[model samples]
Target: MGIALKIVLALVSVILTISILLQSSNSAGMSGSIGGGAEQLFGKRKSQGYDAILSKVSTVTAVLFIVLSLILVAIE
Candidate 1:
């Protein structure tokens, strides 16, 4: 009903979209894991380099998505 809330939600949706895209695949990449093998079964859980960033980003994005969805529903 309010313009401010609409703008905020739009901005949030954009950020959520961007962040989700910035993240690389859980697996290394296509050329490497595309075919498939035991290595493809899962990703290792360690405080490694990029993976740590990905994991953290995923968590924040997920929470934001949930919160934003709830807010939109409540507003409606």
Candidate 2:
């Protein structure tokens, strides 16, 4: 059980990294970095198609990674 969980955790980590890398950058430079949060929060910017899918994938994988890490720690 522990070995299986470790394998799954490794896969999830790889997937999370890939999904993050595949997504397009939302911010431009210094200005965009400062204002990008508002744009995202207010729905001024939207993700479509590939970006949307990757965003969701990354989110889920990140959560899964954290949960798996905690579980592994607890098991140990």
Candidate 3:
């Protein structure tokens, strides 16, 4: 049981890492400073398609990672 739990934890860690990497960076920095005006004129930003799905997946994976870590600690 312990070994199986450890394997599941490892898989979840990998998934969490990949999902985080797949998500887009929120910081625009210099580019945002220049393009902020144009974006405002265009209106509110919308997240559609793959980005939205990836974002949700990242969130869920992150939560799973945390929960699994706690479970692993308890088992040990």
Q: CA RMSD for every model?
A: 3.6, 3.1, 2.5
User: lDDT of model 3 at residue 12?
Assistant: 81
lDDT of each: 0.68, 0.90, 0.82
* Model 2 global lDDT (CA atoms, 0 to 1): 0.90
Candidate achieving higher TM-score, 1 or 3:
3
Q: Taking the tens digit of each residue's C-alpha lDDT, what string does model 2 give over 1-76?
A: 9999999999999999999999888668898878777776787646578989999999999999999999999999
All candidates: TM-score: 0.53, 0.79, 0.77
lDDT of 2 at 11: 99
1-76, model 1: which lDDT tens digit per residue? 5566667667767776776787666555666666555655675456577756766776776777677777778878
lDDT of 3 at 30: 88
Best first by lDDT, ranked: 2, 3, 1
How does model 3 score by TM-score? Answer: 0.77
What would the C-alpha RMSD of candidate 3 be, to one decimal place? 2.5
Q: What is the lDDT of candidate 3?
A: 0.82
